[model samples]
Target chain A: MTDLDLSALWVSVQLATTTVLVLLLVGTPLAWWLAHTRSPLRPAVEALVALPIVLPPTVLGFYILIALGPHGPFGQLMQLNLAFTFTGLVIASVFYSMPFVIQPLQGAFEATGTAPLEAAWSLRASQWDAFLTVISPIALRGYISAIVLGFAHTMGEFGVVLMVGGSIPGQTRVLSTTVFEHVEAMEYGQAHALSAVLLIFSFVVLLAVYILNRRFPIHAS
Target chain B: MSRLVAQFDVRYPTFHLHLDLDIPASGITVLFGPSGSGKTTLLRCLAGLERAPHGFMQFGETVWQDETTGRYLPLQTRPIGYVFQEPRLFPHYNVRSNLLYGYNRIRRDMRRIAIDQVVEILGIGPLLERRTHRLSGGEQQRVAIGRALLTSPSLLLLDEPLASLDIQRKQEILPFIHRLHHELAIPVIYVSHAISEILQLADRVVLLKDGSLVGVGTLNEMLTSLQFRGSFGSHRVGAVLDAKIIGHEPQYGLTQLDFSGQRLFVPLQPSAIGESVRVHVLSSDVSLVIGRSHSPTSVLNVLEATVQEIREISQSSVEVLLDIGAPLIAGITRKSLVTLGIKPGDSVFAHIKTVALNEEVTD
Candidate 1:
């Protein structure tokens, strides 16, 4: 593979890994809330979280581009232009891959029920301690699914990175965008090599998830 | 003795629980009731799991909850251990780690219950290396209890810990629970609808029926009361006799119990001489004799007693309460009542057919 293609693959891994980390830190509480909240705003909030799944990637990318632009609300508040940068690509990927991380975590949290958490509380574990010590271990399958799906989805992004990050070489030129660039330049040979890597990597990730799930069954009870 | 006092008024869509209680924080106080009776709800309220809008609870000196001032101590801050109907063991850990989840959380100086002591008391040493899912139902529950104890909780709440188990499993776990209060002396609020459990384990009983408090008293007080009988269904009406093991006739496989200057015989108890135990006698198992008979009979227990109260439970059956130092009830036919003409203030011989030694081993 050419050095540019190798760099694109490396960029894809970095972007997927960073996106997964950021999503987990932000999505965990959101997913838990979605799983357990009784507020009337729950359905609306859920609908908002799910918008990225059904809405076109270009549309989400367009809105995110504006939000991170110099004059937009977030840009004005931070006073740092985030558009067309690695950070911009990551922020867009976080929004793009949110449902992939959140839905599984929410389902697992719902399945875990409140009994074990209550048991932990009764045994003198604070709320945070119980979540870390009890809920996290029991809902491990959901975590696995969330991390894998979020990473793979972020790796496969083309339209969002194209709109927001603009395929900057060695900066935001991820594997999917590189594949697009190769196909556009009629370099099918290099495109096939990178596409095969993406295909095999995705297959390995899903296989790992299934194998882990089989070894440690979903119901921890 | 310190008391755990609570007042809760919770209204669900279809049910409401209104109770005001001041119970001694010693021994096992059972919350006994049928399903939908709010027995579990009361326990939850005490544990702060259910935050009743109109509620106030105080354990010893700490005010755990008070809705008026909006002061509510989260359950984790309360020094209490709660075991649910299911074992609720942490699935990710082995028995050893599950038992120490709470133990490792508290400060070193605050750890009163040593892990070794709980393991020994619960007989879980053999299973410590095993995963929780690999353990039997009874074994899992024992580990759960051990986990709670290792936290050094001052108050323990058990909500039908045996309700999920089958009969054999219940029997397997009951003796372990019987050893708890005797060994540790932590006040336990145990919830169960099983009459047999109440008879075997309760030091005090709080009866509930359809979200209302029926009565609260010592086991004997509640047992002999008509309200308890009504709640328990009349057929379960009986007396709980606290007795001392005076002698064991191993040749005949019988043990002798002494209660209030009266000697009673039951199937051999595993307890030692001078050890106190509780015995249950079903009212249906007793028959009255007009006078002391000299003829040989299969009945092993015959005590001279005076009649106390007679209530006609049915058109054909009458429950005759008798006093043989301690109160005993005999369910006899109305025909016998009329034929023998038994009434209050009369002297007679009470023939007991069977006696159940509560299988509780006091430490």
Candidate 2:
């Protein structure tokens, strides 16, 4: 592979890793709240989180680009221009891959129910301790699914990253955008090689998830 | 004696509960009621899982809930060990880790129960290394109980701990519960609808019906009282007698028990001499004769009793509460009552069939 392809692959890996880590931290409390809250707004919040799954990536990226522009609200508050930067790509990937992470985590948390947590509380575990000791272990499968799906989903980003982070070689350019650039330039050989790599990687990640889940089912009891 | 005083008034769309209780803070105090009768709800309130805004609770010196003062302690703050009907063990942890889940949470200085003692008491040592999902219903419950005990709580609330188990599993877990009552200093409040469980474990019985407190008394006082017999259903209507095992008649395969100066024979039990046992004398098993029978009878227990109170149970049956040193009940037909002209203050003989006497360990 050329150096440009290698640089694009590294950028994709970096973007996916950063996006999945941020989603894990941010989506956990959001998913936990979505799983447990009885408020009428819960459905609305859930729908908002899931919007990216149904919306075209370019549509979501377009809005994010506008919001992160120099004169926009977030840009003005942070006093930084985020458009076309690696940070902009990370933010766009986080938004695009949010539902992939949250939906599974929410399902896991909901399935745990309140019984074990209540049992923990009665055993003198504080709310925080109970969450760590009882709730988190039970929801480990969901976390694994969320991380794998979120990372893989971010790695496959094309329209969203292209709209917000225009292809800049060795910087904004990633494997997916690079493949699109190669195919547009009529380089079928490079496109075929990159596509095969992405295909194999996606298949292996998903296969690993299914096999691990089967070996260790989510509901322990 | 120390006591758990509670007053709760809860209102729901389908049920309304209002009751005041002063339970003895020792042994097993059973909250006996039918389903939807608010027994489990009350237990949950005691555990602080359910919050009743108008409720008030004080266990000895600690005020768990006080609506007037607006003081409410959350479930984690209260020193309570709750065994839910389901085992509710952490599926991710093995039996040993599940037991220590609570044990390790408690400060070492505040821990009253050692983990080894609980493992021994529940006989769960062998199952310690096994995952929770691999254990049977009874084994899971034993671990659950061990987990709760290891918390070293001042109070234990068991909400029908055996209700989810089969008869054999129930039998397996019952002795462990009985051991808790006998060996632990922590007071327990057990909720169950089964008369057998109440008779076996209750030191004090609180009867509830339709979300109201029906009666509260010792097992003997409640079982013999004519008022509470209706709630126990006709088949289970019986008196609980506190008796001591005096001798074992190996030749006859019987255990001789003495209660209030009266001797009774039951099937041979494993209890040693001088050990106290609670005997259930079903009212249906006792046949009353107006005057002492002079002829020989197969029934071994025939005692002189006086009719204290008579109540009409049905169109055909009447429940006669008799004072036979200890209280005894007889479900005699109304026809026999009228034919023999038996009334209050009349002397009679209580003939209890030998096979009907069930011996249970006193809590």
The digit string of per-residue lDDT tens for model 2 on B12-95 reads 889988999998788889999989999999999888999997999999988999999999999988888999999999988888
Q: Single out the weakest 10-residue window by summed lDDT for candidate 1 chain B.
A: B354-363
Q: Model 1: residues >4 Å from true position, as ranges?
A: A216-219, B287-298, B304-306, B310-318, B332-349, B358-363
lDDT of 2 by residue, A24-74 (tens): 999999999999998999989999999999999989999999999898788
What is every candidate's C-alpha DockQ against the true complex, given to 2 decimals? 0.69, 0.70
Q: TM-scores for chain B, in order?
A: 0.89, 0.87
Per-residue error for B218 in candidate 1, Å, reads 2.0
As a whole number from 0 to 100, the lDDT of residue A55 in candidate 2 is 99
Which window of 10 residues has the lowest lDDT sum in candidate 2 chain B?
B354-363
Model 2: DockQ vs. true structure: 0.70
Residue by residue across A1-221, what tens digits does model 1's lDDT show?
99999999999999999999999999999999999999999999899889999999999999999999999898999998899999999999999999999999999999998989998998888888899988998999899999999999999998899899998899989999999889999999999999999999899989988997898784466
TM-score of each predicted structure versus truth: 0.92, 0.91
Largest lDDT belongs to which candidate? 1
